[model samples]
Target chain A: MAPPEKIELKKQAQQLIEQYDNFLFDCDGVIWLDEKLIPGVLETIEHLESQGKRFAFVTNNSSKSRDTYIEKFHRLGFKGIGKHLIYPTCYAAASYLKEHLKVPAGAKVWVLGDHGIETELKELGYIPVGGSDPRLDDEFHPQHDLLKVDPDVRAVVVGSTKAFNYMRIATTLQYLLHENKSLPFIGTNIDRSYPGPEGLILPAGGSVVNYMSYTSNRDFIDVGKPSKRLLETILEQRDFDKSKTLMIGDTMYTDIKFGNDGQLGGESGGSLLVLSGGTKLKDLHHLIENPASLQDGPSLIPLKYIESFGHIIHLLSN
Target chain B: MAPPEKIELKKQAQQLIEQYDNFLFDCDGVIWLDEKLIPGVLETIEHLESQGKRFAFVTNNSSKSRDTYIEKFHRLGFKGIGKHLIYPTCYAAASYLKEHLKVPAGAKVWVLGDHGIETELKELGYIPVGGSDPRLDDEFHPQHDLLKVDPDVRAVVVGSTKAFNYMRIATTLQYLLHENKSLPFIGTNIDRSYPGPEGLILPAGGSVVNYMSYTSNRDFIDVGKPSKRLLETILEQRDFDKSKTLMIGDTMYTDIKFGNDGQLGGESGGSLLVLSGGTKLKDLHHLIENPASLQDGPSLIPLKYIESFGHIIHLLSN
Candidate 1:
């Protein structure tokens, strides 16, 4: 297969700012990294705001609440983004459960994530269980056979967590495998590895869910980026023209694939790849040399490529 | 495919005691059920002994050590059997590690079963860890991520245990997935369910091992019936004419299959199915009706079918 042809938005340079009305931005590597603002991110968002463009921040981290994320945004000098515009994967999971699964309102959702997800489940009118509850476990002396099992648990939701243990997994298995096989087994994302401090990589949600899924031979529903379920969740709240709306991110597999996969719903998708966060030109060159090796990116290349979000300024009419 | 045809020894009315010098017996259903001796079992064994036939008990239950099994034998009126004639799956697992995996004699085995297996590991000069060390765990306060991992641990052995919990599994995954992928992961048996009191079924060794095997995506070397590895372990210490040895048991899937699988090394294998302990002739008729449905059984049928072990006495010569 021929390598995807990428159109440099700066080279074409004609009404580039006029193409998209609603903009979806990936948070990590694009807007900021390690609690620091990346160069040109603030000015680009300010430009989008002046053009009356609709934008939202999308992230797969389910550790914190949307309010916390927005607070981080302000703390890191990002202006014009609000809590409503911040779409954390926890919210996506909550929305996906409510809108798609339509689980009974008062039913309990057994969670295996941080407080962020627990808060979402509660705000969304579901009883949440098994997250950071000191009463739920003992230090290396868990009596798993004495677990408090509730047959009314409607779903098992998992994400990144430090408190993951056998009691929770055994309880989830009891709920999913023995008690009720139809209960939704879900996770925020399927990322196997995530960045930790000092170049150390920590295991993410996928590692936690692997044993659960492997035991039952059941696949979990991932509601994070590249799944398009998150996009569906965002679109469910408001209207957007998929043909004109743009998804901009630093990653290829998730962010760009999210844009490309967004097109699969019978519309064209706009994607902008930024080098400041994830992909290098050489990575794209490798993809171009062996397009078939692309694990997650869509068939089409990003419509624009730049060194950072700051470079989008050069493509504008300002 | 044609269904296997059985040749009842009574049809020939010949001296059955003249056929084999070594006899291997599956204990659970063959000699006894629970603590009660099965009818005719005593007489059949007495007849075998009078004829100078050497017999041994083979069982998949790893919850008890060989000495414990022998104590049960003597306590239940089997006076001829000794500790050397008892081959428990726990012992087989120990032998497999030493003979097959060739794990260093001084290395730790890291068991996930009961003290019975722990005893066997120690007796064989390998250190055992993580079975029921109360100091290694606190009641409901398991810190799985903080587990103290030993670098010198050579193998992880799992068997049926009521104490199977998350800390052991987490530690095992840490060793198998992160520490060393080449480490041999072995289990004692493949029995998913075992008989319990008042006809209640119990989750057995296979259930505990399933999660470990599933997490590793690696098949465990099972040292129990139907696996043929246990038989190899028993043969490691003693030599027998495979063509002249007979395996007698209640279940067709494990015992008959064990006998049949034993012949895979290019020798004649003998098997006897007893109705007093397990599957009736009607079940065999059902299998014959749908021959393709036989799951773990081999292509060969039992050499004879009897109502109980006592029936074997009638075939013996004066």
Candidate 2:
């Protein structure tokens, strides 16, 4: 199939900005990749701010904390992004465990991800252990000092990490299986790969957990976007009129598929797909032809094209 | 609080033996602990053999392969226990994934339990990885391998394992959370604890998954005895008359609770609770008075009690 005709997604987004009171923007490929901001992204935000639009950066990446993301945005010239920047990882994990596994507040846990997951678990009264500051010296190594699994450790939560190793993961599995077989093994997300500076790279938390499951013959539960848990968290947080609110994302699998359906965010919510990242233009042709391929149809046809946020600002001003 | 005045569980078993043509026995605390046979268990088996009664060993411990359990039994002095030794772990895992998760048979999986889980996953066409002989200087750490999380890996199947570690568990969580968030995480059992030679140890497979969940902040889909998945597997296995087949176990949680009217197993079958393990005599009084404590309720009761296999044989012979 031919690639989707470029139809100016930014222009359409600009038009929508005029109509809508609030704007939800995705992070990762939409704003920046690694340390560099996407061209025109800052200008788009600046334009939106000047026009009095309420915007929230909604991200599925659960590895880094909001503080980390905010700091990264600041470094990239995003001026006023704050804690309100929403992430689905920690919220998803906490809600999934609480509702499905009935993990009570104050439950003990062995965490292998970042502050996002640890902080969320703590808020739910979960006792988190093993997680360390990634910026600290060699904190990611699963050696003797970091290798021990507490007998009382009730669960193991996996998220994203920069310094993951086979030894550390194996040690955690050994303790979980041999020491506390009754405890749960949970993962915060399941994005198979993530965008890295070099290109798409191994997903930190979800991929590692998947591998451990293969070797150990165990199963893990995921709590991030596209999962019902994450959608529920979004609903709880937004509490907006479902009929009016729209979930806009770039990926077909995580964003569009998880939104709009009662399966995740309830029946009233709507999902809009954008053509900036993940879901390439070629994939849309395949999805359009195959009904089953798109588990749930998108509420609105994805804006076909966008070169940069600058175009969005230009379209809005015009 | 006192133990029920020495009810002759042996006498009741003898009467049942005289009344029925077939007899079923539960493994675990009734017949053995780990590799060691339970006390006086052989004598009862011999007596049952002498009485020419048709019997089979039924178990919910799905961690060990049938051959392994049979071999253990033979080494412990009970010879010729046939391949009909029933295990619920593998069947439960497979059926639940097939029906609920709808995982294709060809999906790759990281299995972290025993041969039973591995063999079953293989039969379902799931790619199984990991495991090595402890004696072979090879380090017996298949779970530590990083390749288990290959992009092709679709699910994590957890069961029971003796060599599970923290690193292995943490890695598995990472993969599930970041790399393959869509991949299913399944657990074969959810028993919080199990009997060990030293008394009660961690219930290996499901128990490990449970603990990891607490730490990891994830949830798991469990498929084992007492779970609805087990009964569904059993019903799918054969078209036996549910009314005629009796479910017997030494534990109230898995065994008795699986009787017809129980939560998961439904109301077409009967259950017999043995007192040799799991539930104590005092617990029965508590259950009888506080019906809510019994998850399956009045439908589950001790149909017959036997001190040991010896008593079962004695009853049959008389």
Candidate 3:
């Protein structure tokens, strides 16, 4: 396969803007790092909006609900970005239980994440338990009541949580192993880490998800980026033309593989790589050099590369 | 291979005792469960001692140092069980640093476990850091001082810890990923879960070690059971003849494999599977029926099956 084309020239940026009518973005690295928005990202989004292009913010972060995300977007100067324009893994997990797994409404769902998953499960008419409960903060005890499997829990959803303690983990394992491991285990993502505030590389939701998966000795349904089911759900829900949409992300395996494997962007190809997040140019080059290192090696290679998504506006203006 | 021979008769039990002069016992499930001693186990050990047989306790639990283990042994009414006879993985990790890796004395070792690992590392003349630190108990903060990797830390040791939280995980990750993942990563064991008090299956050290390994995308050196290096270390240190040794445990993958792969008991074979702790007759039957289920299929199967290690005493007396 050919190397990803560099999008540094003004005409290249223009062509990119004209080629795709819809964009699916990975939140952490593509749009912003933590609470700080990347420079010129707003301007680029404004440029796309001025041109009538549509987009939605897709994040692997499951700690915050859509309502909290709207507040963050609004605080970051994104105008009129409503809940519909956001897609966090917490919502994906809840919807997966409801839509894909056909779990009945009002069924209890076990959670090992933060408040976002609890709020989203509740919004979907499911009672969330074992998440953000004050009792989980207690020290580890073998006789803890929460360690017993609650027969009412219809499914298990695990995602990112800062409150990752032995109490929470031991309790969650009971459900995963309950009924001969029949529970539907949903994992938010497979990302190892994310670029955090102050250039710190922080543990991401995938680490927590993988931790549970490893401990339980069971495979989990990944509902985050690169999961074709998640992509098809988003595309169908938004009514976006797959041939005209593009995936923009900072990571290769999750973002680029999502676009490439989904067969996005018709003849032009779909995925665009950016260096503003966890991935740098050197990392891309190394992947290109060692495609066989990954299982689906060639699929993770993006079609085009840029300094950052925000750099699109800089290229256009210059 | 044929299914393991059942040792339920008096003659078979006496013949087994005469066959092996040395025994390696797994602490959990085989001898005791938590603080309670399994009935008849003490009498069985006394019988072995009266016959001039040698034995050692090899536990995957890395949360307690050998000194602490000696105290536990005394508390449980066992006489003369000293530090040299107990081989916990915390000591294995510290000794591996000092002997195998040849990490110099006075070097700092990063720890992601409990006071046991710290105590063991300190005993080996290595300064232990990032373990049982009060600051690690603090809530998640990106700017936490411990997040910064200490340059002097030579290796990272990860084991089981009930106080597992984001702070310890994040800080350990920096060391694991430091210098382009150059640091040696040592994992205490690979036991997924252990039988705890109240018949609860608690998450073991392997889960924590695997979590870090998955998050860092790096392989760690196993310092616990089934690691040939650890088996060799015990045999060489104790001067036990492998041909006359038997490994008794409830777990198949760790304890049984340790004996079988090490070629214990020579032609008579090694590894005595007990049904008292974790594995049941059904689990052993399932494994026997489907040997292809494991990577090293037949090696995981034990040479003999018993109701419990303590049952041998009952059979001999009857």
Task: Say which candidate scores most in TM-score.
Answer: 3
Where does model 3 exceed 4 Å of error?
A: none
Fnat computed for model 2: 0.00
Give the per-residue Cα lDDT of candidate 3 at B194: 85
Compared with the true structure, what per-residue lDDT tens digits does model 2 show for residues A278-299? 5556657667677464445442
Q: Write the per-residue lDDT of candidate 3 for residues B1-318, one digit (tens) a residue.
A: 888999999999999999999999998898889999998998999999999999999999999999999998889888998789999999999999999999999999999999899999999899999999899999888888999889999999999998999999999999999999999999999989988898888788899999899888899999999999999999999999999999999999999999999999998798999999988899899899999987887998999999999999999999
Runs of candidate 2 with Cα error greater than 4 angstroms are A1-11, A26-47, A58-62, A74-80, A83-247, A250-271, A274-318, B1-10, B35-40, B60-63, B82-246, B250-270, B275-318
lDDT of each: 0.69, 0.58, 0.93
Residue A27 Cα positional deviation in candidate 3, in Å, after optimal superposition: 0.6
Q: What is the TM-score of chain A alone in each candidate?
A: 0.85, 0.76, 0.99
When sorted by TM-score, best at the front, the candidate numbers are: 3, 1, 2
Instruction: Tell me how far the alpha carbon of residue B34 in candidate 3 is from the true structure, in angstroms, after superposition.
Output: 0.4
lDDT of 1 at A269: 45
lDDT of 2 by residue, B251-291 (tens): 66666666534332223235556566666666666776776
